[model samples]
Target chain A: MNFDDAVRLTEILLGFAFAQQSIEHFKSFPNEQRLFIPRFVLAVLLMIGFQTAWVAGLLFLSGLAMLHRFQGPYNGGSDRMSLLVLFCLCLVYLAPTQRWQEIAFGYLALQLVFSYFFSGWVKIVNPEWRSGRALCDVFQFSVYPASESLRQWSKSPRVLFVMAWGVMVFELIFPLLLLSRISLVIALIVAAGFHFANACLFGLNRFFWIWISAYPSILWFQLRFITAN
Target chain B: MFHILKLLLPAVIPSWRFFDVIAPSPRIQFALLNSANAPSDNDYEWCEFRPRPAHLSFLQMLGRMFWNPERNESLFLVSCAERIVQQPTQHSEDEILKRIIAELKTNHSDSTGETTHLQFRLLLVQRQDSRLQQQVVFHSRIQSLSTQDKT
Candidate 1:
């Protein structure tokens, strides 16, 4: 898809994904949930293609309320990234010129790239992460285990070490996703697989949706700035 | 100079870690202590802080949906406990203990009931490689709780 189409696709997909969680949040916290219910409805409208830009703005305000009600990010990384994506989308809608829209998406793309690269660097610096002990430890104490079989694998140090290195290497090289269409496709597929594995094992379901939403922006930035040039 | 400063910003800024890093070895658990310098096992069990009442399943689900259900303000809690441990002057200890107890009371208070004089001990448990090498990082009476609470 082209950049604009990609942007539209991202908005609809994110709207649908967040709507479920938003409704769940509304149901969970009766006292602070009032604002989120309206946000949930607006998100569904955004998905249904009703006054997309205006709905996006309302969604942005409600998103801010949700952030405040939680006193910070409720789910950490995914929440923060989701907020950024909403801001970027609103900016794209507000931009007066095509050049400004391109820049806005490019900024989102930069944040996405930095997130992975920065995370990888942090891991490589830590002794525990470097030793592969971190992954083993997480699997051992994960809240929602995929199965007893998966938990048993945490006992094998060699397997954990290999998996740790694999994750670190892939994340470090994640920026290479911007190289070309073929590379970007492959990188995204691999990243999707990684996110799917996390969701299956640890039930980090929110991460999958937020991270996938950024892929379109990354693709747009690469095509507009690097490939097209 | 500008490029170097730009490069270092992410390293300096704290947000980048973003729960991406996993801690190794011993898993950390926090236990709430009562005003008597003992665990408040009357309502909630002393083993761990699992939210009671089956109807609050949504809250439990919300906890699992985000991060570990057991950890809330965990890093800050540990740091405060450590500060009290490192400097055990009567004044400092009293100040920290007062703060912790006040926080617990506020968090657990029910508006419908009369104010209660609740004194509880906070225990920081770290389970090591196996069941044997566990460490008690913090108990209410840091110096005497293990013996006192046991009895």
Candidate 2:
């Protein structure tokens, strides 16, 4: 974490993506999720888990309660089992370890790699997806509701062709971009634009934004660890 | 640096501990095995622990089928084998068809296969559907099951 990176982190904690954009965006969007309120509260109460573990435990449990409440009555036994297993896993992570923290960050990177590749795979296998209609279908997902102009543009043969190619190029070789250090920057920038456009255009909920921003940190962590190893 | 990342990106919660040293501004990873997780026990990366080959697990192989069924006909092959083994004598293709259908109706519910019972249940339906292709199991001389059945 360099000086600039430190600045980036402070803004993130303050719910600012970057200084200028954060201010502009914050002013525009007053009522979305506050990026750091809960964490900020937890940090202050627990003093960052340095002095008291209880505060961290309470915060973790409260979050779990909220998540469970949202799911509302598991109809399937399998889903219940999956949730139980997941909860047990989270408990295992709270143990203190310098090394474990490193692994946690690595897992986040793996999530990024897996999600892009898997999502791309899901698109590729579908015939509808291969022909480019899949992109339209995906865009229609509640995440990216196309505006009338965007919808009109989507129908153009040229637009469809470009969309088809873009989907394939972005998804098919997604994993490779992550693996190759030099290419990742390219992958990240394009992917960010993709998500940002989706968010701005369709009001798509991109939890993926937070997920991906964390990626830059992950790669830095991974490189350091590999060198140390 | 660690302190700075924490002081800065609190919502950016590091998902795993793997990047503690290099987290650009402190990082986050999800679904990781580490000491941050307690009660569940596993903390080391799979590479660090056991250090084994990357063979696919049984469930993983089954999941591949859901991607596309035609490519995986193992279920069809097994059904054909079972019919041949159980009623080798019933020759006339019509009689065999009847027998197979009967077997299917009687055994509509699939029995447990290794890890999860659901695999067998899923396979049963697909196998029944494939039987329409009537894939013959090589040369089997059916001498006439009518006489065998009645007399």
Candidate 3:
């Protein structure tokens, strides 16, 4: 197929994949078959406010998780590790301020900061991802079956390089927005862009939708929705 | 009591775990208790690690919808295969492929000779091999392949 045809075909395939995964995701109500459920659930819950309690419960639980991490039985943290984690996370669960700006900035900063640090950590381990060559290979692996005959632009190294740089720049800068006055808005746009790119470039449809869906609350700053309990 | 001991002694000393399971797919599970004298057999370990599906997340959902379409086909393809097969049996991948191919051949017309079946069997082997080299998700390839077999 031509470029347009390829794009359309990919969309159909993505839909099939999404429906399949969605069926599995909701099979027994929120399967941990994947990582990043927070991002997944939040991106999708972007539209509706009628289900305010559901979101509150989710954020409350996430805050609780932060608390539990340092104090629970599975807490295998060292003295220093425990102290450092507990100090930062306590602000999330117990802090008194409920301002839209602070809550939005803080929550967005925390989630992206954590994800950025972890993701950057993994990327740093591999030199190729940083330089952009590694990403090209990842794309090639997806279309390898028909790589010889097919017409996906992702097969090109230059495209992968631009993508790799885009990802790296976003990760490097996405957390900074959390510290700024207009940081929440910027971060929401970047997160949306990041997920949308994944949908277009890779066959990672669930990642795109779930991540985008979660963007609604983050997009509009509100301590009330972010912290239900 | 003596006969029972005789049976128990041989089984216990054999140094393997044998568990017979009766499910939709009736089968036996066995493991080696002592690797020192473990019976060297192919059935001991099939998949080094069981099939792990792609991660589930909002980000993952997004990836599926907008990015990785080909990656998504495997999910439906697996469901399609599951629906096609009446009796589910867990066997060697090759054996499963062979059985499905035979079923497809039987469903075809007499005008189509056994050559079609041979072509299908060959295609499955090639696809299976290519998947290993290229890392095609098992779920997507399985159904697509079986459909190729049937068609």
Best by lDDT: 1
Off by over 4 Å in 3: A1-109, A143-159, A216-229, B1-151
What are the chain A TM-scores for all the models, listed individually? 0.92, 0.61, 0.46
Residue A221 of model 1 has an lDDT of: 80
Candidate 1 regions exceeding 4 Å error are A141-150, B1-15, B18-21, B24-45, B49-151
Each candidate: chain B TM-score: 0.33, 0.19, 0.24
lDDT of 3 by residue, A69-139 (tens): 21211111111122222222234334466453345334432443545445555564566676665554444
After TM-score superposition, what is the CA distance of residue A204 in candidate 2 from its true location, in Å?
1.6
Candidate 3 residues B30-131, lDDT tens each?
Answer: 221222233334433322111224334555444345344234433222323333343333322333344344433454334234222221101111113224
Candidate scoring better on DockQ of 2 and 3: 3
| lDDT tens per residue, model 2, B15-134 | 222101110110011112212222221331211111112343435433431221211112222333344444533332223333332333344424211211010100111112212112
**lDDT value for model 2:** 0.35
Docking class of 3: incorrect
Ranking by TM-score: 1, 2, 3
